[model samples]
Target: MNKITTNAFHPMQLKISQADIGYKEILISGADAQLQSGEVCLLIGNNGVGKTTLIRSVLHQIAILRGTITLGDKNIQELSVKEIAEYIAVVLSKSAIPQNYTVNDLVSLGKYIHYPFYFELSKEDQKEVRETIENLGLQQYDATPLKNLSDGNLQKAFIGRALTQNSPVIILDEPTTHLDEKNKIIILKTLRKLAREHHKLILFSSHDWRLAKEFADKIWYIKDRTLHAGMVEDVLIRHHELTDPSLFNVNEYFKAPHIIAPPLYKEMLYSLLQKNSTADLSHLSFEFMDNRWHIDAKGNGYQCGSFEEILVLVKTLH
Candidate 1:
């Protein structure tokens, strides 16, 4: 282990290469991802693609078969788990809180990292916890039991826990899964606020490419046996190089207006559009998809082609 002078003001970042764990492997990988003092990043990929594995390796929760992960200039292997916890906060995919615990009690747990030995939270710590709960709109559920709350509220409580940790870096795994559309937006927006307003470095994983592209400053795409990290547009457009299209079905993502829509309407519209002809099947114009119609030569617009044309247009654009 090598020691370097650490600066609290410096940004946190993870650099890794040739790391592997269990049945999963990520080789010949090197990424210069700087989670600026404050910024949000999205980790995206298909199921079992190693996004969680990479995050775990960075946190040193699991052993890395090979390669080094550095936070700033310090190697993660050289730091104790407690040391890492001080700078990084995590929200896991599943939380198993005691069903009897109140929301405030659950959120107050975040303060444990800062005051590990305290039997009771200090006035200031309590104030911070209350504020975090309020900020996340969890005030109404403060006294509610964890098991009594909806999935969305439980998810928000978990976020509040992370916020209470007040770490420079925060990591979440699929925070929006099982959430309604409105809850998804609320969580994403809260994450954005944490990055931009509080200057916290936020990294989260999701299958929602559309939301990730809109909200993340950078994206990490994991596939086959490689890791591609860069601007969302660059990585998404270059997805073909990472894996076989037939195997991964990357084409479905190329659709026009790749926005996250209400589940029922999104599927219905996609199905209907694929049944039509005469639709401009060239580019995936997001504007066109959103408006549900495109202007023709007469300046009057009509609902564009059938579902088939829309699907073709989406593929062509990609």
Candidate 2:
């Protein structure tokens, strides 16, 4: 029996070192991840970081070079593809819809998993399909041909299809790739609600750090050929250890008068503030240290090197 770690939360889902990818050597060696019920996990890394590969590996659509994945105490390898479908639903980067398929037809296909060989739709399935369409605000497009719909509408239809599957876990790969800002927020907010209100596990990969930090309960950061997993704040702050100074430029740009550090550095500064618990960061302005590349807080044109210093200044106030 595999001894579960104390840190392991009740797994809504799990992906162990399974790699079914074509590469002879593992693209991601010894990768292990777990998602708790009702939690949203965000997978983030630069392009070609094996996010899709890992997803496929977990689903057993591809064979693992080594290792095992378990979902809710059941080994993934032991489950048939159809059995896995009952627990895990996926929305891929691209969902191909037949040219003649209507939004309602596409969403209705999700029920095929539960149907017998004849695949007759029951009243319950039809009700679920309809509810999914309305929940995603896709009622207006229900009769529209998928090929004729806009990218945003089409994406929502894809999500509606996944919801109709009624699985406990939904995995998406770069879901916001082609979406505009408004649609992106809508999709993300919808996923967050699904996790919180419906008690589903929602895992998605994205390049949007700001949105991920704001919405995700946990973050999986892949860098320098390794995976680090933790709360979003912890992973972001620990990113400094993996920074490649030569490959990327690091600079502080002023958003208003306050210096806005890059995501990684900003998280680091926030971690420092949290450690000291002194300075009320809600009021301080941020500036960058030109020489050391550290972010510092400033107020009334006075620089505070650390959170403790900021606290002393705050004490002097009033």
Candidate 3:
């Protein structure tokens, strides 16, 4: 595990009190949160909702229009750039990727803050860099130039650099943006592990709330110009929009038939039947047995090999 020693007297929480954040006009206001260390927090909001702006304010890149954000008891404005770097390691989504830097070269940059720019990395720092690379499953690309790596691999490399920095707090802006489903899972799971095992306070913003929620210990949801922070389930339940995306305005135009199968298959079959007819389907029944769909329509019997087959048969009924 990566550990960074800090003054024991300092509190281990990131506290925001009535903070109003924006570059010029306040985009998000009345935000208050007391996020503790040793947990993963996921920041979520719609576009133009100040997710990035709030993150920038927390990093002290942009001044807060009102209220205060503190790391322990010290105001963020009081911390120097180097002091902030020591306390927080950040990975931005739009960070410029260097052209000729290899995986090892990029990841090693994390230790530069602790040493002179011209000085070479110490043996211990080099070992940490190598271990970070291996932990991120980037050993295969350790020597490969970053330009030659895929977008997903490049994103992982950036995360590796942050991990090597080993700050008490790690903040990432959409860390899993360029990753595929598998890679997305890998990165989120790794962050969760780091928070639980290494006790790092991890905060990351992502639009993939459905998948990200599983790995998050808490959620920082910005809505109605306020920041709502709480346990994942609590926040999600408080904001019904998160649980119900409202992607489709599904109407119960057709009554559903008795569906019997595993939950997954049964729901899918019912949805298919409902979508195809506006008339009552309560008289119809479907049961899955022996790996086949046994459907009854009034006094008639039909069978389907698959959902597609069931759909075709359903359309004929309609």
Candidate 4:
């Protein structure tokens, strides 16, 4: 086993080339990407599309069938588990929570890599743990039991533990699992801050691409047994389904109504109007004014109090 320095604070890059990742059979092939420190990358794919397999391969928990994964100057396979731990800190979504452990206790475990659990933490390590908790906005809940905390706070506590690890690279598998929109925003914002301000390389897997892409610098998209790595916008624009799955189901026969409303209401009206077909496909305009929908069908105007009423009117028009 080779020993590597644990505290070198230089810019690090993770590179993958022509890799095949999976267990018995290859799940994802031709995987290639380069991710640098100070960047937040999002790993996106449908369920069971080897997102986790690729992450595990990078962590060297599973061996790549072919090609190479290099972190900085060293190949991942050549690094020992402990050495890899020094480089990467991970938070798995389904990792078991210690039943009776306090938030402070769980977060302090991150320092065990540097200081053994049996020994008292040096003052510097203690301060680091405290700062990590405070940075996570978990200072008030530091002494609270893990079971007592909400899922959002518990997820942040787990992230606090990762922050305390002080590794250059941080990987999270579904960090926003089961979190509401507010918590999801909070978690992603925290990751963006860590990557931009702290210069930590962050790779996180998520199904929430609509929201997650806004915070990501790069995207590692697993599709059709290939890994596509590029700027988030570039990748999303190249793959239309990532932006809107409904594009696949566009009805050639359906005539869309001219909807004038807020973007949100306009999109909703377009979606709802798609399901109904009018016999007279003449000019139809639906305008939202004063919180009500004003409809004009071939110069005949009707006011709709609600979406249901609008649909009922559509039926009458048909």
Q: After superposition, how far is residue 45 of candidate 1 from its true place, in Å?
A: 0.7
Local distance difference test, per candidate?
A: 0.71, 0.72, 0.84, 0.85
TM-score, per-candidate, Cα-based: 0.74, 0.72, 0.80, 0.82
Candidate 2 lDDT over 26-112, as tens digits, reads: 667666667877889988888887778777877888776767777777777778777788888899988777779999999998788
Winner by lDDT between candidate 3 and candidate 1: 3
Ranking by TM-score: 4, 3, 1, 2
Q: Residue 65's C-alpha lDDT in candidate 1?
A: 72
Clashes of each: 10, 0, 0, 0
Q: For candidate 4, lDDT tens digit of each residue in 78-143?
A: 998888998899999877899899999999988887665699988998998998888777899989
* Model 1 lDDT tens row, 34-129: 456567888887787678877887789886776677776788888887888887899988878876899998899988987745578989999999
lDDT of 3 at 162: 91
* Candidate 3 Cα misplacement greater than 4 A, ranges: 1-11, 245-318
- Per-residue error (Å), model 3, residue 172: 0.5
For candidate 4, the lDDT comes to 0.85
Lowest-sum lDDT 10-residue window in model 4: 1-10
Tens digit per residue, CA lDDT, model 3, 90-120: 9999889987999999999888877788998
- Specify the highest-TM-score model's number: 4
Better of 2 and 4 by lDDT: 4
Better of 2 and 3 by TM-score: 3
